[model samples]
Target: MTESDHRAKLFGTDGIRGIANMEPMTVETCVRLGRSAAHVFKDGTHRHRILIGKDTRLSGYMLENALVAGICSMGVDVLLVGPLPTPGIAYVTRSLRADAGIVISASHNSYQDNGIKFFSRDGFKLGDDTEHEIEQLTFTGRIDDIRPTASEVGKATRIDDAGARYIEHVKRSFPNGMTLEGMKIVVDCAHGAAYKVGPWVFKELGAQTINIGVEPNGRNINVGVGSLHPEVAA
Candidate 1:
């Protein structure tokens, strides 16, 4: 049987994941997923928008591009927030009233691994039924013929303020009168999505922050200094 003939479940309780550029995580699969998701979520008279974010991984670039391509093909505009934590993407999606949100990361996985997860407009993971529909559309190629054309085709734009917005949201969680002042903290970002915003949040809260895993060369993520490698931070 072909990959599709005997296709098993694609999305898990979280989302689709595997070794980057490998069978389940290949660019092709992401494209199919994007288009399928757009097909499922687009609604109303106004143009639809989706938020996409990624962690620091070399394969992130490839998958992000593929997802953008697939989403836009369905006439749904895309907001690209490069290199933000998964939660950051969800916050942006809810704040901006997006149709959905996509996150590109493998969480605690090594740099060679990657995954895609989606959040709804309400900043929560999509339900099983919706995820199943997206999978069906992808595997069945039902969205191929329905692709949009011309100006109606969705566009992808970078959200320059995405990181800032997430940072502010996090800061709001702290008590209004309280601050992290005088507190010395070490934050390990895993050199992944949270590298920038993680330390910045603490610093903005008035903490003296020692940020590690903040410099991701794409390959160093989850290496020896992130939440996965806590000792490295010490």
Candidate 2:
């Protein structure tokens, strides 16, 4: 391929995404991207932590594992919050004071599609300069030699309470004294990221919550639900 072809912008406004298990979205690319991001955020004398979250896509397990492997290989510890919403990941990242956060999702895309997005410790998405840096590192292999050894190699852990923490954070945003005490609400999570949290939020607020599109079995996300199909909630 030509240099120009290789130089395509890997990260879009929403992060790097495409058909899952394909080209830029493949396991290899995700791993490289993870390492590249670790390189960019590597700093200071203290331990660095990266947080990862994912939607309900089947391939999320693969991508999440690949990211953990890559980031840990670079000596950056990883916090894995399985099947969480993108926004929640950002919140957790900032709340925990992690160096960075990653979200694995295809958004409104079908199960065969997926993408990766990053957030800074401040909960904001990484900007163009950072994204470009990550892309360059992945494509050029410039930092392949920066690997850390035994004692320095980072670790990964699953944070089972992350979802509850995020839920509590979101609940604090509900208007004070306003409860859905007697209201019937239908939440369509698109069988994607917000499945559990969506209903949980409504119920916690006192709503008679009815949820749809909350079941994701690998290849079913966004099949005919989620924000992509508002009609499903209607």
lDDT of each: 0.88, 0.87
* 1-234 per-residue lDDT for model 2 (tens digits): 443554585777788888878777778877888898898888898999999999988889998988898899999999988888989999999888899999999788888888999999899988888888888888886989987999999999889998899999999999897888989999888888888898999899999978898888988888887767788778
Report lDDT (Cα) of residue 97, candidate 1. Answer: 89
Q: What is the lDDT of residue 24 in candidate 1?
A: 75
Residues 83-145, model 1: lDDT tens digits: 998888989999888989999999988889898999998989989888878878888956679
Candidate 1 Cα outliers beyond 4 Å, as residue runs: 4-6
Question: Which parts of model 2 have CA positions greater than 4 angstroms off?
Answer: 1-4
TM-score of candidate 1 relative to the true fold: 0.96
**Candidate 2 clash figure, as a count:** 1
Query: What lDDT does model 2 reach?
Result: 0.87
